[model samples]
Target chain A: MRFEVKNASFSYKNDRKIFEDVNFSVDSGDIVAILGPNGAGKTTLLKCILGILKLESGEALLDGKDVRRMQERELFKRVSYVPQAKNTTAAYTVRDTVLIGLAAELSVFKSPGEAEEERVRKVLKELNIEHLIDKKCNKISGGELQMVLIARALISEPEVLILDEPESNLDFRNQLIVLDTLTKLSKRGIACIFNTHYPSHALQRANKAIILSEGHTVCGDCESTITAEAIEKAFNVKATINEYSDGGNTIKTVVPISVIR
Target chain B: MVEKKSIKILRTVLLIILPIATAIIALMIGRIAISPKDVFLILTGQGDMVETVSRMTVISFRLPRIILALFVGAGLSVAGCAFQGLFANPLATPDTLGVASGASFGAAVAILLGFNAIPVQISSFIFGILAVVLTVLCGRGKGKGMTMIILSGIMIGSLFSALISFVKYVADAESQLPAITYWLMGSLASTDYKSLIVGVPPILIGILILFILRWRMNLLPLTEDEIKSSGTNVLALRAATVLAATAITAASVSMCGQVGWIGLLVPHMVRMRLGSNFKTVVPASISIGAVFLIIVDTVARSLTASEIPISILTAIIGAPFFIYLMRRGGSFR
Candidate 1:
């Protein structure tokens, strides 16, 4: 499956246009990142593609059909979303929260049964958070909660997974857990699209990137699109990209030095 | 959160049995005290051991009130539960949509117009729905829909309350004023088979709808954008919640003035025990609400020779108990 955003544009009331005619596409087995500075409409761009905010122009398409035109069941069957951890602490047990992913499959009058429960447990196990199934969402750590949210997005068996700041509030180890899971899922032919503040993360995990800079937007292969100039321009900072190697593996890191005037 | 099958069955049995057992006890000990044997005889159509006056007291006077107690209690509590979830605030109650005040305003107008049981109920029902409709229309704007809804509901509630006062001001003090005031106090005293026939269906239908859609109700506490990602129609879920809750409240208030506390109290008590799963909460609110109201109603009629309004007693009995529970129980959130 291919998830594409074409000519997307949005602006808040009385403000200048946030981003205009932004375009990107993520195919199966691909990991994509939407990286930008604060107020650069990175979240806004994800919201537009996910159909949370209506695009002032252009449309989001899944296999050539306008996503907003698709019914929730038909559309979400192909695409699922994992929102930021801060916005999703509903006080349900972890098992019940993951069962919510099947909302479109069940009728209004139907409760999730044994079959659904099995799927929820399977998904939780895949994320290695199966022990947290009976724990309430509010009681869990932020990192565990993010994993639960990911479990929910995956329970639908969607081909396209979109996440907003999936690891923003986590510690280093948990960040690795989330990004590693994304890489693992992408290997299973799932298309992963995420928005982030870290350009190094994009270069490290994403094969393709969309970097929203001050006036120019760069969207293509991560190595070329996330250049040192792109980082300085997007974030208003002086930065450099450095690469290290351990045996056969090469790791790329971007280090920021000073704020630009 | 997941109980064993046997334990779940046991809980369900207790919920169903508690209300029935309490209702039977309530029937036996009303104004005319009757024995358990006689009450059983009357219920089973073996009334040879029962006197005519006792039979009338059991069959004619007490039965309808008990039934009304069951429906009104269940209706109001379910409405309260729905509102709490829809607003995602624990403090939200059945009156959040102004249905109680709206119905009261309609009843006040009808009383001033010399209307009795059926007409007043009809008027109250219509105005209750109308008030929510007007609130929805006024609340449409460019911000969070729930905040706008709550603000508009408050304004509409206040508006209906003012209208009710205006009706009182214009009413004939000798007859209409007292009747209106007594009605506003809220009692099961005037309930009979006739009004029951006219009033119970709307409340019953509303409860049925909420009961069927109970699983989907968990989504009510989720933010609008959050709910959208689930691919469920949040708008329809919200509309169903508001309309069903309004129907329950309006019908209940129209049937017996504006009985307070039960709507706000019962669901909280259930959530305190069952957590926030609507699958359990909705059904528990129905059964526990019925039991709670029937007990209150029984106390209201038997404790004093002259019937005391239920609204007065619910707070008198409920507030202290609620506070105690809140203190003893862990965080309600």
Candidate 2:
């Protein structure tokens, strides 16, 4: 299925545009990475695509239907969103938190039944977080929490998965683990899109990259699009791009050499 | 997950049976003690064997007071649990949105005007609801965060409480002043079947709605953005919950004056035992809260020749227990 954003534009009050004429799309099995410096409207673009924010112009379509016109339940059933981790003091168990993600499927009068519970357990196992089912959310570490959040999102079985900075607070090994999980999900035919501050991560996993810079967007295949020139232009950094063959696949990494104004 | 059937059964038994047992014990222990056999006989329609005064006491005084206490406790505690979830704040209670203070001001105003008991109740109920409506309106728009709703409630509560103080100042010192002061401190001394008849419907209906929505209420403690993204309308759900909770809080305050701490303490007690699942927590709050207030009300009546205010006894019990819970540290999780 085609999930596309066409020339979407948005602005907050006082009218300076956060992003203008931003356009991109990801088909089934495509994993897209969104990369930009801070305040680059990366999160804003994701919000717009998720229908959380109304676009000033243009539209996001899921399977050729305008997302804005779809009911909230229908939209969420098609697309799932994972927000960045924050310190939550609520004392929900990991199972309780994940069960909440089944809201789109649950009728208002019904609590999560045995089938729903079984589905949640299966999703937790899929994300390798089965052991955390009974653990309180506040007791979990950051990486574990992110995995739990992803499991929460995945329980919806959304065709398109959108995540905001899934690896932001994680250590290096944890970051690789999360990124690897996203890549695995994409290979299973769920189109995955996530924002990352680390360009090297996008180079490793994303088939396509969209970089937001100066109220505009650059989108293309990751191999050609996320270049040293693009990083210099988007982030004002002098960076070197290195390539290596890791067995059967070519790996790309971006190393910042110096800061330009 | 393996189900702990024994623990679940024990909790259910304690919740349902404890309150009724407490109510019965309370009925027997007042100044004029009745034997358990006689109390049972009277309750079972065998009052013909009992003395006149004892029969009258059991039916007219103790029964209604106990029933009203149960309703007030359950109403306030359930509302407190819902509001805490809505605001994601453990310390939040029924008065967090100004309903209790507003009801007090209305009762004070009615008292100042020499209104009868029924008029005072109606006035209090109206004003309590009005206060929440005002708070909701004041908190509308871009800054519609939980903190803003709470701040607006505080502002409205302060306003109503100040008005209550002003009414008290102008009241007749010999009679009306003392009555108003007693009411403000809270009591169920005057509660009878009539007041229960007036108060029970709204409280029952409100609690029923909350029970049906208990599982959904679990979502209230999460981020608003996450809630909305999950296909639930956060504003609509919160507004409906607040309205239902407020109806019961208003009804309780009007019936029995302003009993405090049941709202705040009972929910914490329930969470400590039930582990924060609203499905269990809401119902548990009802029974536990009912038992707690009945016990406290029993002391308020039996401890002194003249009845002591319920709020005093509840605060006396609640504050220490709350401190103990906080000290326990892991209790919150």
Candidate 3:
């Protein structure tokens, strides 16, 4: 499915405008990263484009259909959102937490049965976190918990996966684990959109990037959207995009110099 | 880890039997100590050997009260379970939204006006619903969280409590005040068939509705965006929960004023022992809560010649267990 945001804008009451006329579109098997500095409304833009928070004067179209018009049950079945794993509030077990992602399959009177549990098992196995199924979600390591949350999103069987800071607040290894999973999922024809603080993450894995920073908006084609100029403009820091070769794969890393206006 | 399927089935079977066993035991151990055989014989209408007074004690007095206790316990516990999950707060109870205090104020007003049992119950039910509505009105706002609802509940609860005191201030000291005061403390001594007929339906209907909605309610503890994105209408689900919880609580309070702690105590017990699945927690709460109250009521009447208030016994029993569970730190799940 192709998800498109057209002329979208938002602002809080009595607060300055966050963004205006921001337009972007992403399609299946695409890894799109949304990057911005603090208070640039990266998360807020993600929510608005998804119709979670209403756009000020634009529409988010899923396959040319207005998202607001689509029933939530149908919409969520095709699109899934994942919060940061550690943000989980309840002490639900890993299995149950994943089971909740199949909310579209459940009704007021109908709960998940054997078939659903079997699906949960399959999804967890696919994510290689089946071992953590019975463990309390609170007990799992942050990286494992992120995998569990991914399993939850996959269990919903959505075509589009949007995540808020999917790899933030993680150790280097765990960050790699999450980023690699995103690449894997996107390769499987799932459109993965995620918010990130790191510009290199967007440059490294994203085929498409939307940069929301300092009243400047750039979209489409990671090559153009993630330039050193865009980085300096977005994050207000002088930075260099360094290139290194690791095992025949060219890696790009953003190195920050000093704060700049 | 989750329990084995067979063991879970066994626990369910045992839970279903628990209340029946307690109720039967309660029936036999009152002031007039009737034998098991005689109690059974009386129930089966074959008790020629049992005295009329004993039969009356079992059939007319204890039976109605036991049944009342069963409904009251089940209602309060299920409400508590639902409320706790709904708010994602362990301390949230059926009365968390001030339904109990609302009902109590209604009953106090009824007593002050010299109303009978049925009218008192009706008044209580209406006011109970009133309190929940007021709480929602006071608490609801865009992007507000459960804490707002809880704060509103406390505010409304205190408002009703103060109203009850006002009713007492002007109540007939010799008659109405004692009646209102005793009713507020909670008791099952005044239960009869007529009142039960009016009261039990609300509790029963509420339980049945909640049981029907059991699957959807598992989403109760999730964060707002998680729930909103789940494709289900969370507002409808939450509204249904609040309505059902209010109905059962109002009905229970109407039948017997403010039987405290069953909601918190029984649900936590069920959750601690059975895990946090509402699939198990809802039914377990219904079964165990009934049994818990039957035993408590029996002890209340039998332990002392003058009947002790049911609330006192419940608090005496519930507070320590709650503290123990709190200290252990694994029960909330």
Candidate 4:
């Protein structure tokens, strides 16, 4: 499936325009990283794609179908979303949390059957969090919780997975874990769109990068398109793009040697 | 593992047995002090005491009131549990949604207008439903959260309460004022088989509906986006469940004035023991609430020559316990 956001724009009631004429597309097995500084409407753009927030103009199309016109359940079946982080208000075990993802497949009046349980167990095993099945989600480590949440998203077997800063709250190890998981999911033919602050992670896993500045996509291409000039222009920071010995590049914010004095 | 399983089984067994024992105690040790043997005899139908005072006391007055207490208690508690789940707030109850106040306003209006007979009950039911509808409509959100719902409920409840007060002020002092005041404090004193018959069906049906949807109630606290992404229609499910819960609450309140505490405290108590899963919590609330109210009503009738309002006794008992629970973080999920 292909998701195409066509010239979409949105502004809040406070007259803060979050997105303007932002157009992007993702095909199956593509890892698209939306890169932006704080307040660059990275979250807003994701919401627009998920149809949680309405576009001021234009539309988001999923395989030639307008997302706005599609029923929520239909859209949900095709697109899975993992929020940045959520506070567990009630005590739900890891298994229970993941089982909620099977809600769409079950009848409204009926509980999840053996097949659903089997699916949930399979997803848990796939995520390698099978040991955390009976553990409380709130009491678990951040990486485990992230994996559990990803497991929840995968339970629906969605074609497209939209993750909002999956690495935001994690430490370096967990960040790598999450990024590796996203890369693995992409390899499984799932189109993964995520937002990240760290550009190197995107450069490592994303086949494409979208840079948003002031609610507009200033740059949308592979890593080569996200140059030092674009970074300086978008974030108003002077940075040097250095080519690593491993054929990878790093955009490091530069300060003059005289500033150290 | 075996010990843990045994403990769980023991807890479950205790949860069932304790309530039954309390109900028996409530029935046996009432104002008349019926013996356990007599109680058994009266229950079984093989009894020489049928011709004597035992039959009249046990069959007519005590039995119905006890039964009323059980049903009213269970009904209100179940309704409270549902409301709490619906609002996703531990503090929510029928009164929070203005159903009880609306019922009070309705009954007060009926009394003031001298609408005697079944029409008064109908009027109460109408007002109760109307209050809940108004609250939900006023509080319904485009993007606002539970705060709007709670604020609307409070605003509507206060409005209805003010209206009730206004009606009281204008009411004929000799007849209506005392009646309104008495009703406001709440009582199961006037309960009969008729009101019980009218009341139990809706409560049972409402509880059944809630029970059927109990597992889904887990979805209530989740944000709209989360719920939608999980493949549930948040709006449709919320509307249906809220309406059903409010209807049950209104019906229960309209039947019996404003039997406070049972709705508020029983659900909390249930959650404090059982987990917050509505599947267990709802049924636990019903059973515990039934037992609690039956005992409270028994004390209300037996403690004095004349009956005290069940609400007063419940408030006296429940208020302190509620505060204690709140202080101990018992209500937090």
The per-prediction CA RMSD against the true structure, in angstroms, equals 2.7, 2.8, 2.5, 4.1
- Across A6-118, the per-residue lDDT of candidate 4 in tens digits comes to 98888888787776877778999999988877988898888888888888899999998988788877888889998766554356677677877777766677666567778
For residues B17-85, write the lDDT of model 2, one tens digit per residue.
Answer: 999999998999899999999899999999999998999999999999999888888889999988888
| Docking quality level of the chain pair in candidate 1 | medium
Angstrom error of the Cα, residue A119, model 1: value is 1.2
Superposed Cα deviation of residue B174, candidate 1 (Å): 2.3
**By summed lDDT, which 10 consecutive residues of candidate 4 chain B come out lowest?**
B324-333
Instruction: List runs of model 1 lying over 4 Å from the truth.
Output: B1-3, B116-119, B129-159, B318-333
Model 3: per-residue lDDT, tens digit, B22-132? 999999997778889899999898867789998889878999999999989888999998888887777678666788899888877887888876787778878987997
Model 1, B170-207: lDDT tens per residue? 99999888888887898998889988988899899999
Q: Which sequence of candidate numbers ranks them by DockQ, best first?
A: 1, 3, 2, 4
| lDDT (Cα, tens digit) per residue for candidate 2, span A189-243 | 9999999999999998999999988844799899888999999999999999999
Q: What are the candidates' individual DockQ scores?
A: 0.62, 0.53, 0.58, 0.45
Q: Which candidate has the highest lDDT of all? A: 1
Off by over 4 Å in 3: B1-3, B95-97, B114-119, B130-155, B321-333
Global local distance difference test of model 1:
0.86
Every model: iRMSD: 2.1, 2.4, 2.0, 2.3
TM-score of 2: 0.93
Look at candidate 4 and give me any clashing residue pairs.
none
